[model samples]
Target: MTLQTTSAERVRTSFDKQGMLRAIGATLTDVRPGSVTIELRPGPSNRQQHGYVHAGAVSAIADTAAGYAAQTLMPEGRTVLTTEFKINLLAPAVGDRLVATGEVIKAGRTLTVAQSKVYALSGENQRLIALLSATLIAVDHVED
Candidate 1:
């Protein structure tokens, strides 16, 4: 589907309102018509038993990216919510930072499909840490 709004700033504004992202220190790095990238510098607080980033953290970012990617294509006054997602952890997430990139595969009137890839970045190297596929539903925002 064609983009309804390609305003990156608007997308960033919406992204900034997500309190979970703030709590996790995730930053919206890139926003495009059907894609978004989020970066996170995981601290000790986000690590698990083996000193690796927790699986939940990885999934959270991936999910957020995919949801945002679908939102980017939604018409004005509409918002998207994740209906379902499946994620696979491919590798241990140990690195200086993690980057999640989401791209929309299909955009429908009510439903959109997106895929996300999470990479663990250490120095100049990046390792694939997880992959996610999500289905999002678009709903009209009701303003009070």
Candidate 2:
């Protein structure tokens, strides 16, 4: 398979293991060498007052996308963990779905920095809802 295909598959497989991502109805939509996209439909449990997507759900998807973006660049047998993150909720997350696009800012042997921009999608329009900056660490994976 091509690198893009392999990367996408790897990210999707790892993303499937995330309970919170699944709970919030987020799915891995795209993956490349240094970028990934996650999409979510805000369900009843994902909303806060005013029937908007909660900040926690918004940040969770963004953070998870960032980690997967970094993971795409790591060597085999390696995975990523978020060390720190900062998210800015630019607008109310009120739409049919939310899409978080994550891109690697810098990739290093042990640490990586990435950013994710979350957008609320309605019909043919998408609005910026949140921005997330994250730092992640590469670690060896041990399968059980």
The TM-scores of all predictions, comma-separated, are: 0.91, 0.93
lDDT of each structure? Answer: 0.87, 0.90
Per-residue lDDT tens digits of candidate 1, residues 1-144? 234344566688788788877887789998888899999898876777888888888988999999888888777888888999999999998888999999999999999999999999999999999999999999887452
What are the clashing pairs of model 1?
Answer: none
For candidate 2, the per-residue lDDT at 84 reads 99
Stretches of candidate 2 off by over 4 Å are: none
Positional deviation of residue 124's Cα in model 2 after best superposition, in angstroms: 2.6
Number of the top-ranking candidate, with lDDT as the measure: 2
